[model samples]
Target: MKICVIGLGLLGGSFALGVRNTLDDVEIIGVDKNPEHSQKALELGIIDKIMTMEDAVPQATIAVIATPVNIIEYQLPFVLDLISPMGVVIDLGSTKGNICKAAEDHPKRARYVATHPIAGTENSGPESAFKGLFRNKTMIICDREKSDPIAYQFIKSIFKDLDMQVSYMDSVEHDKHIAYVSHLSHISSFALGATVLDMEKSEKSIFAMAGSGFSSTVRLAKSSPAMWAPIFEQNAENISEALGSYIEHLKSFKEIIDNKDMEKSTQVMNRVNDIRRVLKGIDIKS
Candidate 1:
């Protein structure tokens, strides 16, 4: 089998490594708009070869679109138009609604599978790629009924071999759920980093006092703006809704603290403490 991974950034590079490690007798080719990324991907052994998209599709048994959300929207349809019916197309974009909608009426729509792997880092480019990034992660496949059974099975086989569990959702549900768990978290981290950096400018020695909690909370702020900006734009409605709810909760806490209402403040603390317990129950380190 031959696999062509479009966009040799962290996600694409990782996918290339995963497929090479897990799938025997498969050849990997990479496509990147940036010539430097293409060179880096080859230098890092992320792909077996660097190939043009026009030359790659006919020979590729599977096409993995790991580009940004907006580019994925444009590339997916073109891939479907070019690949054989037996060939499969998979996208690893974070936001799915727009991409799914773009493929809705395509002639080979069933050959494509919409997927979002619940794994990533605050890094970008082939240099940031690492092996085993997707191991033990959950991959959400949205709108499966619209996919061809053979193509869907092929994707599941690949992810399963990588030790990932496959889950299913509709595009709307995926967006809403991710807005709370993923997108909102990124926004909070970005805001925290901006706030702390401002404070650091005034308190020159504040870094010495920063603890693990602050470090962990602000980590996602280091994520690539080029990648995250389009994702946030694509899901603006859901992101805005999540942000609004978060602000309301914060305002309530501020009111309690300002009034010196010990009971109310403790009640708020207890409610927030319950969240830690809930997170613990889910096997998450809170």
Candidate 2:
């Protein structure tokens, strides 16, 4: 099998490496908009060769578009046009509705599979990629019925090779759920980081007093904005809804605190403490 990865960033590079580590009789070709990333991916053994999409797509058995969500939307149709008749195209972008819609009208839409792997760190670039990044991660394949049976099976086997758990959902539902579990969290982290930095400007002791809790809470703030900004924009409605609900909770908590309603505050926290069980259930499932 021949694999062509469109972006040689963390997800793309890690996927290529994972395929290389697990699959035999395979070749991986990488395409990056940035020449520096192509050189770095090649040097780091993330891919066997670096080639342009025009040269790479025709020969690839599978083309993985791992670019930012917006770029993926713009280029998905073009990639589908260039892919061989039997070839499959899988995307590792976060938002699925826009991506699926972009290629839905294409004649070769059956050959495309929209996927979002619930994995990553607060890092970017090929250097940050590793062989096992997707292992045990949940890989969500959206609009599976739209893809050809052969193509769907191919992606399932490939995700199995990468040691990921697979789930299926409608593209719209995928975006809505992710807005809460993924998008909202990133926005919260970024806002919290910004809040702390602003406060720290006047209080030099803020950094000195920072603890592990603060570091962990703000860790997603270090994620690449180039990748995330597009997601926030693409899923704006769902995100806006999530934000509204989150803001209401904040307002309620603040009101309780300002009014010195210790009993209500304790009751509210006691109700929210169920999250411990919710998280524990997720861990067990994982």
Name the candidate that leads on TM-score. Answer: 2
> Which stretches of model 2 miss by more than 4 angstroms?
284-286
By lDDT, the best candidate is 2
Clashes of 1: 0
Per-prediction TM-score: 0.96, 0.98
RMSD of each: 1.6, 1.0
Q: What digit string (tens of lDDT, one per residue) describes model 1 on residues 1-286?
A: 8999999999999989988888889888999999999999998998888889989987889999999998998999899988887899999999999999999999999999999999999999999887788888889999999999988988998999988889999998999989999999999999999998899899999889989999999999999999999999999999999999999998988998899999998877877787877667545411
| Backbone clash tally (model 2) | 0
For candidate 1, the lDDT comes to 0.91
CA lDDT, candidate 1, residue 218: 92
